[model samples]
Every structure is written in structure tokens, then in C-alpha cells.
Target chain A: MSDALPGPTLSDEPILRVEDLKVHFPITKGIVIQRKVATVKAVDGVSFTIRRGETLGLVGESGSGKSTTGLAVLRMLTPTAGRIVFEGQDIAPHRGAELLAVRRRMQMVYQDPYGSLNPRMTIRSIVGEPLAVHGLDGDKKATREKVAALIASVGLLPDMADRYPHEFSGGQRQRIGIARSLALEPSLLIADEPVSALDVSIQAQVINLFMDLQERLGLTYLFIAHDLAVVRHISTRIAVMYLGRIVEIADRDDLYRNPLHPYTEALMAAVPVADPEVEARRPRAVISGEVPSALRPPPGCSFHTRCPRAMAVCKTEQPFLRKISPERAVACHLHTS
Target chain B: MTRPLLEVNNLTTRFRTERGTVAAVDGVSFQVAPGETLAIVGESGSGKSVTALSVLRLIPNPPGRIESGEILFDGVNLVKLDDPGIRAVRGNKIAMIFQEPMSSLNPALTVGLQVAEPINVHRGTPWAKAYEAATELIGRVRIADAASRLNSYPHQYSGGMRQRVMIAMALACAPRLIIADEPTTALDVTVQAQILDLLKEVTRETGSSLILITHDLGVVARYADRVAVMYGGRIVEVAPARDLYARPQHPYTLGLMASVPRLDGGGGRRLMPIEGQPPDLASLPPGCSFGPRCRSIIPQCRTERPELIQVADRHAKACFANV
Candidate 1:
């Protein structure tokens, strides 16, 4: 997983290209003189491409490092290794001013709307802060009008701009967060589980809002979520991650209908659909054990320990992402020659 | 069916706030048969948890009160039971599992001690015998190295493993009914499936009824034998799991099911989210609480509230326009 190269790229020049990205956290056991004892490979050799104006979903369980990947893509967490090419520029190596400029066009919306927002700040200030940070603030009156407009776009009334984050419910708080992310009108948005904290009915509203925003703004999205159903609804393409690596990447419908990787298949099967009849009939794909810790992952294939179809070769050699179809790629020994 | 193991009727629980008294669970009623899994599905403020809490008589006194309800267990009204009388049944005849295992389990005590508590208090079993029973209980929950792990504290296990400890504790008394509120909401999907399957397995093995409170309809579909959908502190719909999913009679239920994305595939329509936010419990709208949000609302919906009426052999809903 650590050595994986840039995965198969979808043609037509993607807006964001993540190649062999690795974000590792050092586990140091010292106070004054701290030394790295071990490394937790949070995002190990994961790669994917988001076509312009299309949403590429990154799906995985909690420990699979999907959030880490999103953070690295946003340049919030510096990757230990790899290239993040945004709009034809490898922004991964950029520093200070260069990074700041790149960040103006790439914003992130966090999972917990409450924690992500400042409790003390009003909605107007929260949404307009991004504009001020990016030097887009015109004047007091102009910023107020712009904030109101942004708030209206997310379906909240303009008067709500005067209220604090604590005054609103979870769904409305998420809307305020969305308004803030849309403040700069970033070309590429990384929505990290934006709807996970919402109630089911409210979740629909936020998800539909995302689709509408994408349509109107024509923005590329790196939508990261653990819920497969919601991901399928919003994303055009999906990358299934297993222990910090993309096990499979394919078009949304294609991946759902014909998952090639064992991990992908298991993930798809593991999702509990909302229909009892379908659930009763669907074959349960039971992966035997829990995901191994990222600090000391498996030798060859990270998913080998829990994979139902593991082989002797899977334990010895790490398989490269092999193409089974034009738009589908899976990194599993069963799919590899 | 043989007499329902648990029957609830006209259940109304209220909470006192600075503003006013809020009717959290308003005139809700349902039944759970022995060995059956009944899922009470709802959004965050829909009072599903309140209903479960009221059943267990676990609500905090001054701020919360079961205003009026008949929680009949084996033909006796639990609401009328004395404190000592109810304590005998709380963990012995009925057990409860909470959403987050971390908060539910005491960090100061060992896993074995926590699980053995019901046996120690109710059955009056000696500490040594209780611990022996607890070791067996943990093993039954499929926790590997159960005997050794008994010494481990709550923080020592993963989310999934900690939930196993909770389940082991709930099953310690072989209770006739188990009330699990969002049991797997905090765990990963794979672990969720595992825990659910284990919950279903153990409950069936002991012939105990389960009342599963969850927000995820997927979990309901997969785990529930029957489902009672709650909205605005009332039962909007109740039916056998398959029938409810097949032909939803309530507009709220229909909107709720349709609003969620489908892994199998979506309907022709993109998700049509419910129009408004969840109702504020303190001052709910006069008529139907769902009227403001429901799509198929007629003029009368805003003037007159609906009542749950029989739709089929075991199905009922409270919506007037949807039918």
C-alpha cells in the first residue's frame, strides 16, 4: 500500500488528480526528546481522479482513512509522500503563499457541523470569514449582502444570518457550513461526510442541496462518506478504500452492479438497504474479522486478513490495480493475472 | 398470535423545560410479541428514545415524567409498580441497551463485574457464582478469550467489542424483553452487521423479545420483524416489515423511505426531501404535525389531525391523505 503508484486515470482531464498519496502519523513515546517509534499509515498510496464537474465518492469504514485522504487533498494535512495535481499543477509540493493561493480554489465542509463552526460567531461572520481570509471582502455593507445571498442559496432565510450557530438545528447548521464553503465559490469542494450528522429526512435535504449546487456551479466534488446508498445517489464515480488503499474504482452504477474486488464486494454486501425483502434475499458477504490496525498493516495485501477469497499469492505479493474493463480498476489478486 | 409479551397504550411522556412542558411521546401505542423484533424508527426528536426510556421507567424525575401510559408486561401495569417492585423487573425480566456503550458502561469497574451486577442484585447470587456466569455470558457473546478479558476495563476494547460487553450484560439475566436503542449507530458498517446478527441470534436463542430503536431504516428493514414509524412524537405507521416497505400508507413514512438514497437503485425521482424541519416538541403545530412537511397534504390536513386506523391484517397508519 505504501509503494502504490498513481492509479489508472479517467480520461478527459480531471480537475483534481491524487497520485500515490500517503499521510502518515508517527507514534512517538517520549516527552522532551520524542522519537518516532512507529508510523500509522493513515492514507497509504491511495489515488483517484475527479473529472471536471463530476463527484468522485471516496467510501470506506471509519479506520480506512477516507477522512485523512480528504484532509490531505485539501492540503490541511501535509502528505508524507505523493502528488496532488490540481488544475494541471502539482500543488502537493507548494508552500506558504503558493499553498494559500491553491487553497482559495479548494475548500472543505466538515462532518460535524456544530464542531466545525465557531459557537461564538454569527452566521454572517462565519460565512464571510472565508471571503475575508481569501481577500475577497469588499466592504461591510457588501459583505453583509453577499453573506445574505449565500445564506439564501442554501435555502435559509436572510434574517438567519444574524443568529449564532447554536440557535440553529443540525440541518440548518450544515446549511450555514455549506454557505461558508460556497463563499469563495471554489472550483473543487471536499465535502467530508457533510450529511452524516444529519437526520435521515434532513440528510435528504443536504444531499439534494449538493446535487443542486453542483448543477448550478458546475463544481467538482471529492465526496467522502461511509454510507454506500447516499454515495451512490450523489456520486458519478466511486473509489472503495480498504485500510488506506483504493481497492476498487469504477463508475457508480458499474461498481454497484459488478464489483470486482473482494473488498468492494464485501462492502457493497455489508450495506443494509432500506427494503426488508431485498435484505432478506441479499447474500451476506461476511468478512471474518475486524480491519487490522493501520500502524502494523498486513505484509502484502492489507485486506488479506479478512478477505474471504484470499490466496497464498495474496499473502506474498502486493497486486497492482488491474483493469478488468474500460472504466473499472480493482487491486486484488483474483482480478490480477 | 399468542398474547403479546409487551403492550403499550396511550403512552404520553412529557419533559419540563424553561419554556414549557414538551410532550415527547404523545399518545403512542404498540405491541411486541415474544421472540419478535419490533423496530421503532424515527428521526432524532421523534421521541423513539423517550418511548423506550418511559417503558424502562428510566426518565429523570423532576424534568421528565410519564404523564399517562399503560406499559403492560405479562398483563400487569408497570407504571403502577412501586420502586422496589419495578427494580426486580428492570434488569431481571427486562433489560436495556444504550446507543453509546462508552457512556453506558462504568469505566471504574471491570467488564466481568458490570455484567455480573444483574445476577448479584436480582438473583442474589454470590459474587463468585455471578462472575462465573458472567464469564459464560461473555463467551456466549462470541468475545474471544472471554475469561481473560473479564479483567479488562471498558476502555480496553474497541467499539464493537465494548458493545459485545453491553450485550453480554443485557443477556446476563435471560430477560424476557430487551430494549436496544440505536445499539449499532456508533460502530462501523461491517461491525454493525456483525453486532446486529449477534443480537438477533442471542435473542432468538433465549426466546426474548427485542424493541430496537433506530434512525436507520436499513437496520430496521434487515433486523425488524415489525416496524412502528414515529413522527412528531406519534406513531405514524405500524406494519409487518415487508408490508410497510411494500405499501406505505402514511405520507411521512413514504417521504422518509423515498428520501433516503438506495444502494439497489433510486426511483425515477431524485430524492424529494421532506419540505420542513422536525417539529418543536414544546409548541407543535395545531393540526397534524407532519402537515407542514408532508407532500400530499390536502387542505383538511392543516385543520384536522388524523388517527391510526387499520389498513390490513397487521398494518395501521395515521395519515388521511396518503390513503
Candidate 2:
């Protein structure tokens, strides 16, 4: 692996390490020659590490930049600053075939299964494409067997491999996508809202498939989603993002039981409980107004405008992540180091 | 209970799909009392939306038709009402708020004009007088700058604000029944909370019956007085919100409750997902539609259809379980 900077040795390296990552899209103003006027800091100075064989769930509302951060970590989008050290190498500056080589061990499963897969391609070829791309298609017979196994692993029949993408249900389509990701046997997978599009029953099936795959393959995952319950179900650790920054990150149980950040508190409260009696009794703290415009985010704490516990310091100076405990980190002034 | 504001009896709506004639909403019956909130919970293709549309007499013809039903709104059959009679009831006494506010509201017109429409059509009030009422209604829904917002188009409002405008329109003439179809589904979670809070407060204050059609079980649990669980275009179970959650009778209902991951702060068990896909409506089985996926399925279930039988006071389930 080519290193943008000399990273730590492989023996000591976490599976994935993101430090001060920033993904800023330049807003251009021009008809013909576009000039950069300003930048939308979709992901600003976010950092986290996913150890091997563990699932780190990245969760937030829309425009929270969880998806952008996922894309940036995959090196699909170039980051403006910071380091994305995968294994023993910094992937920030990787480009061309070097990046593709690095990506062979890291894969992404998209949200929209219907749009992500080629409608014209057969399920066999769809899953087998990664093998062909990685030049493992010399033995066609062996490749076909591998594709069949992956398809069956995702709970789809090998017989359905020859069928087109449109022939299956939404849940089935998502399974095909997951199977394709497994074709490379990637050690790390970035699944972007994998089951949110699926029905409740089907969603459970797919979510279980992910959990099963993780255990069987020992694959680490960066699971990005907006649903809190689903995240907590599968994730070992959960990171709550608010306006391009991580507001909180803790063990899944700890995060749910006691959230330190006010934004995290509101995000958790906003989720309606499935049990009527419990929901009726629970007092919900409703966060006023929509997420502030990401184009012109607030100076101090991006959330202070709508935050219920906003203080005078919250309006002027930014509060970065501070470790409240050995395992828990919160980005709120209330939780002083 | 004040002679239940609305009662639907054996309502069956069929659609002319590419495959063939399919019963989208088959033999569904329920009642909504005055000041009651009934949540119809189901996934996509479950006919929850069709049921709501059927009650309002808004089923699109040619491809869609209400084959049989008695939608009794104040002792009058809405199914029997003509175009003009139903139009008087539609958006007049029984208003609807759609899932997509952008699509529902005319983008070309100002927010005020669109909201004032019900008052003008129903009350026969002048545009100016109706606009004033619309402004008041908008204010009631807690949309800030309600007066100035009247002049703004639908595009100017945020998703949450547009939903607020939609809610304001629903409350234009103090309608006896308001049917909100996924009213907050398009908004973010925080915004969704705000809209749900606003809708509940307004509905409770006005004492109007609300029929909320949504795929979200969580929303149903929080706001619904009663819940009707629909599956494969049929009402599998209907019970008080608490009763249904506490003790789900039908297999499909139980499976649904188990399938969802509860955020109750005490859970590590794997979700026991229902094994099979929802049956296609057009090629539904002879007897119980859920028979293929049911855990407690018996031989008799595949041969005989079960009618909804009362299990307890105000609780009923249409299943052959322990009968």
C-alpha cells in the first residue's frame, strides 16, 4: 500500500483510522468559467477509528454529512485536508490504479439497490464484475462458482443469478448488491443506509444478513444510516454526527443509555417508540426548526441555534471532541474534559 | 360515543393493474368516533393509503374503482354520494393532508390562496374573508410569519413549513374528520416530531376525528388512540394501541411487532424476521393471505377465510389462532 505519509506499522494499525477529515465541495459562481466562491464543508474535521471485526455505525439526520464522510473515506471524493489511514497507509492522496488496488480490500454497498445495479446486467455478472475487475476472471468456471456461493450467502438462490435486476423485489435487489461487495472479500465494507429502502420484515432479513456476514467473514463495517434503533441493533460502537461533525461517539449501549451531547439527546428523543404504553409515558424533547443550512453553518456550535441547552459559550467558540471517559467522547461544552 | 363520526363497512377497492383486477383494499371495516385518532398501520402495497382514499371518495377511476363499500359519514353513505355531493364533503367537512405537500399544494398559487380554498368553496365566503381565516388557521398551526407567508409560494417554505401549511389547510373549516396520509414522512426526524406535536395539539383542541395512514408503527404507537394492522390488503387486527402492542393476537401482527428493533434501552436478541415475502395481491391464495408466512399456520387456514371476530371489548382480530 502506498502511503501519503508514513503511517503506523500494520501490527499496531486499526482496520480504519480517520483523523481530522474534511470534505469540502467548492460552490462555484460563473456561467462559463466557474470560480470558487465558497465551500460547503460537508465533512469538517471528523475523526474516528474502527478496529478489526467490529461495526461502527455512523448516524445522523439528512445533511449531517455521514454519507459524504463515507464516500470520502472510500476515496471516491477527494478530501481537502486530514488523513484516512487504512491499514498501514494513508489513503488520502491515493489516485488512479493505486486507489483501485487499495479499494479491492475495501468496498461500498449503496442505498438505492435499484439504481446502483445495472438494470441490463445479470445478477451473476453483477456480482462477478468485481472479480473480473480484479483480474480473477481467467478461470471462468471457478469465478461462476464463487458468484453462486456469494449469491446464496446473501440468502438468494444461485438459480436466480442469471436473472436481471428488475426481476427481483427491493429486498432481493439489495441482497444482490451485498453479494457483489463480498465478491472481492473486502476486509472493510461501507454500507450506506443498506436497509432503509426495504420493508420492515425485509429490512430485518437484510440487517441480519449483514450481521451474519460480519461474524462469518470477520469484516469490519462503517454502517451509515439515519435510523437509530437499527444502528444500535448491529453496531458495536455508534457515532452521532451533526452538521459535518461528530457530536458524540460511544459504545452502542452506553450511547443509548446516556447520551452526553444535547443534539444526541434530541436525536434519540425524536425517534418514536414502537411500544404505545412506553411512548405515551416518555416525555419527548422536540427540537425546534429544521437542521440549519449547511451552506452557511453557524460559527460556534452549528446546533446552538436549535439546541435547547445552548449556553453563551456555545454561540461564540466551537467545542471539539473531548474524552469524557476511556470509551466515551462528546463534543459539547457541558461535558468538560 | 357520540354516534361514531365515520363508519366503514366491508369496504373493497379494486384496481385494474397490468397483471389483472386486484383487490387493493378487501373487506376492511372500522369506525372512527368523534375526537378519536385511528392509525392504519401497514407496509407498502398493504392498501392503507387506498382505504383512506376510498373514504374520501377520491379513488382514481379507469384503473381504480371502489367496487363495494359503505362509508357511513354521519349516517350518509359516502360511496352513494354523487360527484357534487362528495365534492361538498371532500375538503369541506372531511379534509385530507397528503404525504408530499409540494405535490398536493399547487405550486403556481400563493400559500394563502391554496389554504383559503376550502373556506371559499364550503362556506361561500369571499376571497378576502377566506384569506383572513386562512391566515388565522396558518397561525394556529404555528407557522411563523403566518400573515407574510400567505403571499409566498409553496417553494419558498421548507418541508416542515410546507407540512404546516398543509395542516393549516386541513383545519380551514374545522372539519369533523381529518385524514392525514404520511403527513410527516417527508420531513426530518426533529421536524417530524414538531409536526406530530403540532398536529396532535390542533386535533385535540378542535375535537375532530383523525385517521392517520402511515407505514411507521412508531408514529402509530405514539399518537394513535387505536390501531388497525393491515397486511396483504386486509385488516388482520384492530385494537386499542396499548392492547395491540401488549398482546398481538394474529401471527402477522406478532411477527411485525417482533421484526422491528425496539429502542427501549434493553434489547440484544436478534430480530426474528418473517421468513417469506408479502403475498402478491393479484395472485392471493384461496384462504388466508398470510398463510404462507404465518408461523402458527394450520391446514384449515389455507382452506378457510376467517372473519374478524371480537376478542375483547374494542379489540378484534381476523385469525384462526386459538379460536
Candidate 3:
């Protein structure tokens, strides 16, 4: 099933390219007259590219600014700095109708299935609402027919479209969300923790549906998640985030086998394998210390506090993200020439 | 071998919801040997949490009740304990760690006060000594600068730090058994590894058995000595951690393992998800609760519930299938 979709060729231009993106929220004090105390640098200087017909898994723990990066790419949350190039056009400065027009081309699938969908709206109305809002739906009758097909395409029966969000299970509600995202026939889908809220059994179904949809529709996905295993399964390439920085970007297998960044290596070691023998044999290189607050991040490398191999230079001098090979890039002092 | 630290026999818990009484934990049975870590693995609504709550007698009486069962902790029947008897045992002997540390820890009280409160109340230790013990436990859980941080509030601490405080509270009295319900679920992967290691290290030092309730199969593989795979309020399969992983007999167990994408590289393998939704307790199928979703269903599975029987030494399954 995976081989059915063609891999992104070198000649093809990337669908989306993010360059040194930074999203900083000013932490204000005082109720009436707020004064900016400090900036919570959420997505501080991150860069990556998502090719057409490929999955770029962005993974990190909470407060790692992964979700902020996704929202920044979608222009939902305005970037503090850097370029967001979508199909060779920088969409960072766009607003009003231009932004609305750009939104139709790309879509988002949220993490919480229960919270994302409107509880009052029926599945038919919810799915078709996007089409109507984008001025894609022809008429009421045409919208109904299109909604039915969308619902059916997501593995939900067309007849069930009349039911409310509460009537559907978590997995079903997620399918509804997927159907809604696909209503506009978008080229890019930024799915942030799409399967995190599902059961182990149900999560597989949703993932399979995602793969099937990608193969059929040739969709480009920005799959953001915290679970490394889930990310590894669905993503062709992965970017590891730590304290609002892209520490490493490499192919999924390469990242797993030869992680250059200390944070990435620690993350890989931290995730316990399912097999008992494998877990028993593997040496655990568990890193300590909690993630520092984004409000007052560490001086140099944000990961230096917990990194196993932190050099003196890592404590003061910030390391730039540089390509070690053609396909892999890492931001660490040890990898520096 | 040695006597079991805790034995739950045919435990059944029911909840009196608006929809009517439904058995959330139905005829569940398992044993946790002395110093052993037994994981109750299940998805939501599988009654894993209810089973733990039932053991501690923490279930709300109006809406929830332990319908029938014997929770034998250290050879004493916890189910037969009176109000004060259970109280003496609840925090003093069997401590529980919940998922959300923020909610579990008191926001109004200092970390030292809360952790010391249990030690003072249960052991009749002096306030000064209790505070000292609390500080030691805080240090034991690997919280840096434990003395100064003890005066800080829960909100001042991060999520992982709050969880460490929760662990410190759980370890105050050095309870013989610790029930951690999805203890690391709310934390990050790296932080989760640290917390689990701390829990294991502390439990080993105190020689306390642990009842780890979580849905992560990988966690069970690493920490648990034994595992109970629960589905629709019953133990579908129970075995040693290694045995269960090596050869999962129940279809539900097999499906769960297959569905989860492994971190150890199986990118090409397609996940074989179990079909249909989890069983609703209020209106479960007449025969097997998992009958509708069971891929290895037989005619008997639809008509009668299968009893858990010994398939191997220290291994049991509640399925009729030959697999």
C-alpha cells in the first residue's frame, strides 16, 4: 500500500517551505494596562520543507512549539519572523481575501475530535459547511450530494451524515473531521496530533484511512505528533523539535538508526519498544531534567541542560542547523565541523 | 512461590448512571506478588481504572459501587473493611497516583505540607519529623533542591515536577502497594521515562508491589512483571510480560499489539486494527462482550461468555479460539 504512491522526485518543487520561522507570544503583566514582561518564544528559528505527495512528521513533547509551527504555516497564528513559502509564493504577508484564497488550497485536521467538530451541526451540514463557505458548493441539492460522497469516502455511511457529533464515537468524529478537511479538495493537510485522541485499535484504522486517502488523492501531509512510533509509521521524513528549535531533520529510518542530536537520541531511547526482549537488551540512555519554560529559555542550546554529551561550547555558543549530508541536517555542537 | 501481595477474586463493580446500573468492572481477577509490578492494560472504558479504585474503596457510593468481589491485600480482605479500617489502609498501606498531578496535588497547600500530611495523619509522626521525611522523599524522587522547593505551590512547578511531587506524596508513608493509574500519560516521552524509572526505583527500595494501570503496551513490556489485558470490563488475557508479548492468545491482545506502530522500525507493516467500537457497558452483547469486534469469533462466542482458563503455567485466556 505504501509503494502505491510515488515518492517525491528531486525535480519537483516543494509544496511548502518554511524558513527560520519564529512565533513569539508576549507575556504581559497588569490587567488594565498590560506591559510586555518577556516573550515566550514558541517557534524560535525553525526551518523545514514539505514536498508534494510526502509526509513530513514534526514531533516533540508539549511546549516544544510544534503546534505553533503548524498554526504559523497555516497563517492562523501570525509568525513573529521568517518566510512561509507555499507553492513558491510567500504567504506570510497575505491577509483578507488573499489569505482566504490561500486557505482553500490547504487545510487542517485538529487533535481533539470531540472538541474540533461543532456538536450541534449534523455531519452532513458540518462537512458541507466548508464547501459553502469557500463558495464551492453549487446549490443545496448539489451540496447534499457532495457531502454524502465526502462522508462515504471517509468510511462513514452517507446515511449517518444526518446524526449529531455526540452520536458518533471519537474515531467516527475524526473521520467526520477528515471529510470536512477534504471537502475543499485541498493539496496540503496539516494534521496536528490527528490520531493521539483515539484508542490503540481505532488509531490504526484512522492511520490506514490517512494512507489510503494520500495514495488516492495525492495529498501532502504535515503530520505533527508527540508519539515517535506513530510518527515513524506514517512519515517518510521527520523533524525533531526541542524547545522551539528543529534539532534534527532526516529520513525516518536514518533518524532512528543514526541520530546526531543529543535530544533526538534521548527521545529515541526514552520511547520504550513494545517487545520485551528488545527493551531488555537495549541500553537505556534516559535524559533527565524537565523541559525549560519557553518564557525563560536556556542561554545557548536549550537542550544543553539535559543533553548527555554537552560540551562547554554548547553552554554559551548557539549551534546553527547545518546539513551533515545530502538528506540529513542537524543542529548540535558535536556535529559541527 | 511467595505469597501474593494482593489478590482480586471475581471483582465486579457497577455504576448507577441515569441509563441504569452497568457493570463497569465485571468478574475481573488477578494477583500481584510481593514487589511485583502488575500492569492492567486496556483502552478507555475497559474498567482498568475502576478496578484500581475498587481496591482502594475510592468509588463514589451514590453513583458507583463494588457489586461483588474480594480485594485481598496482604491476606486481609479490603472489601470487608469498615470506613475507618479502609481509611487506615488507603493512604497508609496502598497509595494511588492519578494521571493529572495538578488535580491530585492541592493547590492551596505547600508541597511539604501535603506530603507530610499523610505521614502525620497515618503514622502519628511529629510535624517537624514529617516535614523532614517529606523532604527526603522529595529528594528521593530526584527533584533538585528539594528543601527549598518543598515550600513552593503546585502551580509554581511544571507538569513533570508536579508529577514528581505526587510521587513524593505517594511515597510519604512508604506504602506497601502503589497504584499508579496512567501516571505518565500526561507527561512527555523523555519525562515519562524518568518518572517510570523513579517509580520503579522507589518501589524496589521499599519492597512494595505496584499496580500500574495504563494503555501503553510498550510501558508494560518494560516495567511490568505480569500483564492483564482488559476488554469490555473483563480480563481477556493475563500472562507474564514476556509470555504475553511472545505469544498473545486472545484476539483482542493480538489486535492491540498489531495496531500499535512500533518504535523499533516496522514501517512497511500495515496495522491490523480491530473492527467495530468498544463495547458499551449499559448494552453489552449478550454473550461475549468482545463478540462483535472479535475477528476470531465462533458460534459459541455469540451465545456464551467464555470463562478464563489456564492455557499455560502462569498464563490464562478467556477465548474459545484455538489460536
Top-DockQ candidate index = 3
Order the candidate numbers by lDDT, best to worst: 3, 2, 1
Model 1 chain A weakest lDDT span, ten residues long:
A1-10
Which model is ahead, 1 or 2, in terms of DockQ? Answer: 2
Candidate 3 per-residue C-alpha lDDT over A1-337 given as tens digits, one digit per residue, 9 for 90 to 100: 1111222346987898888898999989999999999989999988888899999999999899999999999999999999999988999989989999998989999999999999899988899988889887778788888889999999998679889999999999999999999999999999999999999999999999999999999999999999999999999899999889988889999999988899999999999999898999998999988898888888888899888899999899888788877678888999888
lDDT of 1 by residue, B1-323 (tens): 79999999999999999989999999999999999999999999999999999998998998999999899999989999999999999988999999899999999999999999999999999999999999999999999999999999999988999999999999999999999999999988888888999999999999999999999999999999999999989999999999999999998898898789989984224897887889988878878999888778888888887889998989999878855
Off by over 4 Å in 1: A1-11, A139-142, B266-269
Q: Residue B208 of model 1: what lDDT? A: 100
DockQ of 2: 0.76
By lDDT, the best candidate is 3
- Candidate 3's TM-score reads 0.98
Candidate 3 CAPRI-style tier: high
TM-score of chain A of 3: 0.96
TM-score of each: 0.96, 0.97, 0.98
Worst 10 residues of 3 chain A by lDDT: A1-10
- The residue ranges of model 2 lying beyond 4 angstroms of the native Cα positions read A1-12, B265-267
Q: lDDT of each structure?
A: 0.90, 0.90, 0.92
